[model samples]
Target: MSARDWQKSSFSGEGNACLYVSAPDNATIRLRESDEPDTILTTNPTALNALIRNAKAGRLDHLSKG
Candidate 1:
């Protein structure tokens, strides 16, 4: 695997919790948090878009409940 150029939102503060995203290729997306750099999550574009859409619509909120 090659090194990915990770990017974070401009609104992200200079803190350890910032989320970073990268495109390893046209078909793959990579995600990582600054506090846990060694752990990365991968998915395809379609799945990622679905996640974002569902998140915005509060469809995934239940998963966060304790």
Candidate 2:
């Protein structure tokens, strides 16, 4: 985790609620927030792509608190 470079989302606004993403290795993607660097969420490429696709299709809009 320390060796790889983490990048922030371009959509992240001028707030502390920033999203960071990186690949820790060849097989896994790591996601974390700017405020909680220690808390990382790891997932495989397949599942991560599925989540992105579902999110883009508005299939997961219902999960929002707003």
Best-performing candidate as measured by lDDT: 2
C-alpha TM-scores of all predictions: 0.86, 0.80
In candidate 2, what are the lDDT values of residues 1-66, reduced to their tens digit?
Answer: 662589888999877899999986889999999889999998989999999999999999999957
- Cα lDDT, all candidates: 0.87, 0.88
Q: Please identify model 1 stretches exceeding 4 Å from their true place.
A: 1-4
Q: Which stretches of model 2 miss by more than 4 angstroms?
A: none
Please give the lDDT score for candidate 2.
0.88
Residue pairs with backbone atoms closer than 3 Å in model 1 (clashes): none
Question: How would you encode candidate 1's per-residue C-alpha lDDT over 1-66 as one tens digit per residue?
Answer: 334588886767997878988996899999888898889999999999999999999999999999
Output the worst ten-in-a-row residue range by lDDT, candidate 2. Answer: 1-10
